[model samples]
Every structure is written in C-alpha cells, then in structure tokens.
Target: MHLDNNTNSEGQKREYCSNGASRGGAKIIKTFSSRNTTQNLGNNRFNNTSNIGAYENNPLIKSGRVSLDKTYNSRTNSKFNNMIPTTYETRDISIVFEEDRQNAKHYDMLEETDDDIIVTGTNCDTPICFKTWEDMELDPRLMENIKKSGYIKPRRIQAFSFPLITAGYDIKGQAETGSGKTAAFLLPIIDKMLKLKFVSMRRTPYALVITPTRELALQIHEQAKKFCLNTPYECAKLYGQLEKSSLNRELDGGCDILIGTPGKLKDFTKNLQINFSKLAFVVIDEADRLLEFNFANDVNEIINSPLCTPISKRQNLLFFATITKELERYSMDWMRKEVATIKNKRENEVNNKIHHNIINVQGLSKNKLVVDLLIDEQKQAEESDLSLRKTLVFVERKKVCNILALMLMNYGIKSASLNGDRLQKDREKAINEFRSGQITVLVATDVAARGIDIFDLDHVIVVDLPKDDFMTYVHRVGRTGRLKKGTATTFYNPETDYDFKDNLIEMLQNLGQDVPDFLQQ
Candidate 1:
C-alpha cells in the first residue's frame, strides 16, 4: 500500500491510498474527487460506475445500465426511491406496464397498512405470524390451494387470529369485509380437523359453521372444499332449498364439517335424524347479522340443544364487521366469558382497495347517466387497448332490478337481471354470463349477489341505497374490489338518501376520498 497527500486550490487537504495483491503490483482502483479520499458522500453527486458508500446506495440495474434512483439497491428495494436523477444518467426504456405501476402503488401503501393490532381477553396468546402462509408449515395440499388462490402473504388479521383459535380459546374479532377474515378463521379450523382424526370412524360432525346467509355459507363451503379436497375430511352445506331426500342422504352418509344458516339448520334438527355428539367447534360468522335478522333464537337453540355438547367442551368463534353495544353484549353470552377479542386496527374506516364515489342523478337522467357511463367505459377501454370490463348495479327491489336490466338492454348494452325472484338455474346462468363477460352489466338486488366473487369485476353502481342497514351499502361496494382494482359509484338522491349520508361520508373519508359538506355530519 502507498499513500499520497495533496492540497487542492481551495486549500483542502485530501489523502489517497493505493493497494495491490503484491508489493510492486498495480490493480484496479477507484478514484473520487473529494476533500477527503474516503469520499464524504456529503451532497456529492456520483456520476461514475463506482460503489456508493452505503449498501443500499448501489446502482439500480435497469436496461443493462445503472439507474440513479437516489435510494436504490434493487427494483424491490422500496417505492420511495427518488426518480429524479442527481448526476448518473438513464438510457432509453420502454413505458412501464400497468402491472408494474400497480406493483409500485401496492408497495407505496406499506405505510398505510401499518395499523396496530389490539387484542384483549383472557390468557389467549397471540400467534407468531409468518411472512407467507407457506412458512406456517401447513399441509402440502392446503398450501398448494392457498398459492393457487393467489395468497402471497397472510393478511394482518389472519396472522393475529390464528393462534387464539388454534389454542382452543373462544374468539370474537371485529374485521371489515374484504379483510381476509374468512381464511383467518377457516385455516385454523381446517388445521385442527386434519390433526383431530380418531382411531375409529366418528359419526357426528366434528365442526359446525353457521353463517347469516346461504350465499356466505356457500362461499365458505367452496373455500373449505379447496383446502380439504385431497384430504379425507368431508364438508356438507345444509340449506332449505335442497330436497329433503338429498339432505337426508347426505346426512346419512356422514359429514365431518357442516355449514348452513341458523333457520335451515334448526329445521334440520327436527326434520332429519342426525348425531351431534362429536361436534366440537362452532363458528358464528357475521354475528351481528345473525342476531339482527331474528336468527338469534334459532342459533341459541342449536348451541344449547341437548344433542350438542356443553359450552365447556366446545370452542366458539364469532366474527363481526364492526363493533357496537348490541354486538358486544350478544358476543359475551355466546362467546365464552374469557374468550379472546381480536379487533383489526383500521388505517381508515373504508377499505383502501376500492374507490368509492356518488353520482348525483336528476329525476329523469338516471337511466341516461347509466348508459353514458357504459359508453364512456367502452370508449376508454378501446383507447387503452383493454378488454371490456364487467359492472354491477344494485337495486333495492327485485322489480327495479328487472326494469333496470331491460332499460340497459334497450340502450344496446349487454345486461341481465338477477334477484331472489329468479329461479335457481336462471340466477346461476345470469351469474355465469356476467362472470364470463358475455354480458357486461348485471342489475341485481343486494341479497341475490352476496358472497359472489367476480374476479375481474370493474365497476359497481348503487341505484337504490338501503334505508337503514349500512351493511347493504358495504356489501354492494365490496363486490367490485373482490380480486383486483375496482370502482364504485352510487346514484345519490339527496332527498331519499339523506339517512345514508353520514355513513356514506364516513365511508368515503375512510377510503381517502374527498367528501362534500352536505354529506358530512
């Protein structure tokens, strides 16, 4: 090694050193023009292909050249990189695709997802959350389904709620729709079932899940099937629409897990001869709706029925989208006294995944405005070279849904109607057509489409706001952002919808959307 000292014209002392493998040998060495040879990196713009002082300051390798993203190491480093170059140059590059833009935007929301986890109740221990579901050492079959379902990481709620339930502690969690609470409870339940196999054949179901609606039950059933397909576990869906003979046959055949609504299941208690001695786990999803919809007596009947085991031997899980005095009181009785309460901390009151807004439509312009929206969407799709996307319009009445569907068709927009009045086959066909993009618009009552996961749905319009239940509004808007980015627009009539304004305003603000004063309370 050799050292050299020099003084620049500014009278600043600089020290330089040279080193090689051998005493007299010379090798590749880096040079920097700085007051100190160590290169203070103090406000000095780097223009050459030399290593930066910090490990995170490495050149962003893009297009076979260095990209001077001020804070760069790799493309996955962070979205906060300063794109404005300081001294290093950039080369010709192609336009970034929408996928890349979405990735960048998703990375940018890391700060927004830094919500706290507030857990309460007795000796319930919080779960150690793994970065990915695979890290939890789940069964290979379950892990495969999770990956196929596009699960990259367990959501915050899933990470926190898993342990409490797995430990046999009753849980009451408050999580909003689309927050992945389904899998949070389902996964732990499935895991427990896989390990609880008996030495001999068991007659009664080992678990029971009661949901507010048949659609939600069916949704959970589908997910259950996906995870339990390759295993020996059997899950059955019980509802009133099924034939008595078929229901009896399924019950006779045997079921390890049962999912259904309280009313239907309560009817089955007398209508079908079944065993419930082995029942161990009970989940009451959407507990608030279960109580409000007058299913409380039926649910209590099922839980306290002599056929089932006592509360001491059973594990209970209750979930609600929001916290309220009534829900809390109801949960205390059903959920064990020392049950764990897991409440998701929200960065905002509204789901960040969906964009929410209201379209003020005059008396006669409602139909015309809807038609215009379809036309503009088509035009924008053609301009962007994207495929025509699907849209859903929610109506308050089954009759209105049919009329709106007809109006849209008369306007030359491919559309269909779906409501509780439609036959099962007809409703299924309508849903299939809309999902396949055969028809670009679907007009339906909220109850008809609950728990329907349309992967690529692009828009949702609420034509008739529910008079009281804000959950109707939440479920309507939540339909669009199911598996991807989506937008929601409500046809607001200030006079009729004045009761909905406060909730609407709160929802918009939680989604980080700008709101008007009239809508604000």
Candidate 2:
C-alpha cells in the first residue's frame, strides 16, 4: 500500500510514507484479531447469566467497555470506513488508513533487530535501537531543532542509548570518541523534561551533566544550548575557569540543565547551596576519565552531598569511550543495582577508514620529520584545490608540545599548543583558532586534548607513541576519521617504544594495515 500524509485525531499531520505494504496496517490487523479472540474467550468463561451480570455491573469493566465502544465507533467514522488496507500502491508509497494509524498508536511500527552493538543489564527492557528520528517519537519542537542542527539520523551510540534512557533506565554507555555521545544523553533528557512540563527554578536543575575536562564540559554545554533553543529550558555551565559571580548570575536567573566539571560543581553545592534534590537525571560524560584518582574526591563529594538527590531516587547515566575497572566500581557504588550497560561492539576494532602509516625515526631529529610531513600535506591539499587539512600533532610531554608548536611557527606553519600548563583562556583560544582554520596544526598533550571533538580533522601525527597503554594510541588516532575518512602517522622510536612494538603490530594487522618491517622484526 502506498503510504501518504494523514492527520490524526490530535490534529498533528505526520507523513507515513513507505515502500510496498504498510507495516503499521499489518500490526493493527493482527492486534485487532488477537484482542477479539481474548474477548471471546473471556465471554465464554463467564457464560453464567449471574456471573455475566456481575461482571457487566463492575464500574471499571463497564467504563472500559464504553471506552472500547467509543474507540471502535471513532474508527468506523474515519475516512477508511473501518477497513485497514495492507497495501495500496500509489507511486510506490505505502498508505496507512486513518483508523489503522490511530490503532497503531500503541504499537511501534519498527521492530528491534540484533546488530553488532551489545546492550545488557538488570531491569533492562528489550533494546530497541531507534533507526530514525521518527522512531524516537520525540517532541516536535525538539525534532525540529535536530533537523536544524543538520543531523540526518542518530549515530549507533545515540540509536541504542535513546530508548533505554527515555524509559527511565540508569545507563552506562561506552562508545568511541566523536560518536555523538553528548546528544545521546541530552536529547532524551530534554524530551522527558518537556513532557513533564519541568520549570527552571533558581539554583535547582532538573538535569546535571558532569565531565572531567573544561573543554568537554563546554562542548556539551554548547550542544545542549543548541538542542534547547526555542524551548523553555535553560542551560548553564560551570568549570574552574568560570568566575563564581558568573555562575551565581546564571543560577539567579534560573537553570534547568547544569553542565560542569566535578570540582566547580562540588564547590557550588557546598558553598553556594545549589540544590540538586529535584534533579531527575545525572550524567557523567567521559566516565572512565572522571573516575580516576584525581577526580574521585570531587565527584564523590558532588554526588554524595545531602543537597543532591539520593542514588535510588534519580536516574544516572555514564558515557565513556573506554570502560575501566575503576569506572565499574564507581558505578556499583553510585548507580542503582539494576543499571543498564550499552557498549559498541566495534569499540576494540580500529577504524579501517583511517590510513595508518608508521615512520621509523631511528636516531633522526623528529622535528625536521614533522616539518616535512606538514609541508607535504599542505602541498597535497593545494594541488587538490582543497582547504588546508587540519592536523593534530600529539606529543607525550608539555615541554615537547610547546617546543614543537614554536618550531612549526618558525617554519611558517601556523600552529598552536594546548597543554595543562596553559591558562583556561589560552586553551580555549588555541582550540578556537584551530577549529576556525586560523591554525593548521594543534600541538597538544594527551591530557589536554582528551574528549575534544573537532570536525573535518584530516590528519593526526603522533610525535611520540604512548609509553604503555594501547588504548591511548586508539584515542589519539580517534580524533581524526570522526565522521569521515582520515589518516594517521606515528613516529616510532624502536629503542624508546620497544615495549609497545608487539602491541602496535597486532593493532596494525587487526585493522587490515601492513605492519612495517622494523616493527615485525
């Protein structure tokens, strides 16, 4: 049947176009038959006249019968005359009759199918990975904003995380960086708040999102603002760099969703007396990083404060690129006993879209090598008539980060340094400059660049391989190839990085890339 645009009883016009037969019509017909059989069996079981009279007299049952009668009458009165067609071919679009659309309200048109992603936990319903924005049935206003934001569909992480979160499940989600994790948690939370008609109150928020780094927190806050545009909801951000007076001003105006770092949020809860008793949702973004020893105390203080809602009363969400034992332990301590865990099945697999190249800088000056690489990249971009390719040069130490950035500038390559030693404003400036294409290269330390999302990043140059952890390499390379194809080159010092040679070779082989002869040796 060809699907066409139709207005439902609520006067909301929705397009139900699809190819071939209508899935909604088939489900409605099946449900109608099943319900009829159930009613027939109940009538037969209560055949006795006295029992029938008693059942009919019951107020609840009588009301239900009247409601069903009204619903049936309404359907018969619809444009289709009570007949729901399975297929109506008109320009190859399937049609759903008005009555059938109303009946299908309680039934979901999309069915859940198994895929590579894994979701498991106690008190978890069958996972429904929403394939499209329509499957989510979000607020029309929110959906409009989503379209304006230029998102055509939900990412895998968003697809799996939405249904569970909207249904009030505490979730621990693990996905790679740049996988739309922020929106996965934000959209559902905002939708629920809108449905509940939540109002922003002074110093009290309906949702709280905590992240480890200021950059990540700001990024999340920026996205939240975009999603909340034209809605009554208000969003506020707090971090070490933000002044107390600014935060106070924001709270005084009102806040519905508060995003911040652990230390700054803890300070507000203890001193400013910002109440979280009414918070319905609490999200810890980058959970694996936030649960580390340095952030443990502040996180504990913020979540455990009496001003905050108890763990049992609020829904908690933890999202991270990597899952660690410490994160598991923290979840056990703070999250409910029946928390839902959603993990991307391809988390361990390297992205084959990224072309991996290894350069053996055996006793040679690495600075000259990087200069040559950047110059070659620029030449290629110019030849292709494309913009200068954005690149991230990862260094192991802060000293190296600064030195390399300065050296690049001296060589007429626009470059900036991002490290822990820089002030918050400087860090923000560097990131902004890099994003705006003012600087082609961002020399960064792993700690400062973690969880920062940059779009259209073309290349990642690893000046030094992470000493021990293989996951660090994964994260560093993850910055590029975020939503498209990219490249990564790692300078390997056989003597300094000897311990990671085997692991690096295994990773390269798994990703379907050729292992260099030096590494294989």
- Candidate with top lDDT is 2
Q: What are the lDDT figures for the candidates, one per model?
A: 0.62, 0.68
Score residue 199 of candidate 1 by CA lDDT: 25
Clashes of each: 0, 11
Q: Please state every model's RMSD to the true fold in angstroms.
A: 22.4, 28.0
Tens-place lDDT per residue, model 2, 379-413, is: 65577686557899998876556556644554446
Task: Please report the TM-score between candidate 2 and the true structure.
Answer: 0.76
lDDT minimum window of 10 residues, candidate 2:
28-37
lDDT of 1 by residue, 201-276 (tens): 3447777889887667766776676667667787777876667787777665556778888987888765535566
User: Quick one: how many clashes does candidate 1 have?
Assistant: 0
User: Model 1's lDDT to the true fold?
Assistant: 0.62
Which stretches in model 2 have alpha-carbon errors above 4 Å? 1-115, 122-125
